[model samples]
Target: METKFDSTADAVAAALRELIVGGELGGGERLVERDLAERFEVSRIPLREAIQQLAREGLVEVFRNRGAVVRTLTAQDVEEIYGLRVLLEGDAIFRSVKRLDEETLARAELVHRLLGEAATTQKQGELNREFHALLYGACGNARQLASIRELRAQVERYERLQNTLLADTPSFQDEHVAILQACHERNARRARALTAAHLDSARRIVLEVVERLAA
Candidate 1:
């Protein structure tokens, strides 16, 4: 049982990352180690380890004497994150199409259903991330999945802005539906192209939001 519970630090790190990526934790927020340790019901050791991990991931920055704060993205950071998303997610789609199996297809369909439901409930941002994750989940390459996951986390702030600007927009659903249909048809090229287009659309909205936010 001790061994089973050994990864306390890692678990805390993942939880914090998810919170930040899900926008439950916002940019420029300061993280107090002792406070977080108490809040998470863990010892300082694991809490500090977790925060260090987040620091490495660019989610948090450590100051010599000021503690840690959530990293804020500049305009350049926004552009770079979106650019990486296009490259990684686009490649994942191309690879995922060829490796697509019954299990993967089913997962995508389920995610699609959840996305639609999320839209109806006005939780578009969460559903959008789920949809993107499902699209790349079948790539069958651990490193690729990990890289995409990191990029997604880094861009979460921009995504929130995009979702706000496009509130109640069903465009994402339509885009996702087209991509899934292409994958179902075994059209790898079409899937790849559609994924690029999907990223392009998101890039446009996010860029505008970033500009406004920066201003």
Candidate 2:
């Protein structure tokens, strides 16, 4: 039975995003409108709208005859996405660290603490976003922040994949602490370097997962 939602399209999109990011939908799997509409207990219009939303997020690809399919990430895609992230996020963190306010740092610390206690991968991912946003939000560049958000969205599925498969890895948590310390010390150069290295580590891990999946 599907849960009732006031805003059907938004709810449906959120549910589908969870499914896709959780790997239940899998890459390259076609999204059948009739089946999905029936599953979500939503009419075709809202179901279509939900799929279109995913498409805009780069999570789904719309085709003429084939309809919507989950977007599969290639090694090249990982390289490009993480490359841009390194550039944009590195600059953002650098600027943010130099202008770091006490309030933002305190909020980030709170989020980091909550992140450590988060039991579920989904919860951790959400907190991770909040923590990074807090740290980078001090950059005072709206367009740069927006660009970083878009890039993050594009690679989020892979991040979830890494968390699910490599649950024992504490590297991300450790790196977050190091990055936060840099921010605390107001070391813009170190913060930027750590941020770039952290992203590179994630990119490499995701690339390995993609390769393993292909194999």
Question: Which residue ranges in model 1 land beyond 4 Å of their true spot?
Answer: 1-6, 119-123, 161-168
- CA lDDT, candidate 2, residue 207: 87
Give the C-alpha lDDT of model 1: 0.77
Q: Which pairs of residues clash in candidate 2, taking residues 3 or more apart in a chain or in different chains?
A: none
User: Ten consecutive residues with minimal summed lDDT in candidate 1?
Assistant: 160-169
lDDT by residue for model 1 (28-81), tens: 888877778887899989888889888877789999988988888777877787
Q: How does each model score on lDDT?
A: 0.77, 0.86
**Tens digits of per-residue lDDT for model 2 on 1-215?**
99776488999998998898777898999999999998999899999989988898788999999999999989998899999999999999998897878988999999988888888777887888899999999888999998887678766777777465237337788898999999999999999999999998888778888888888
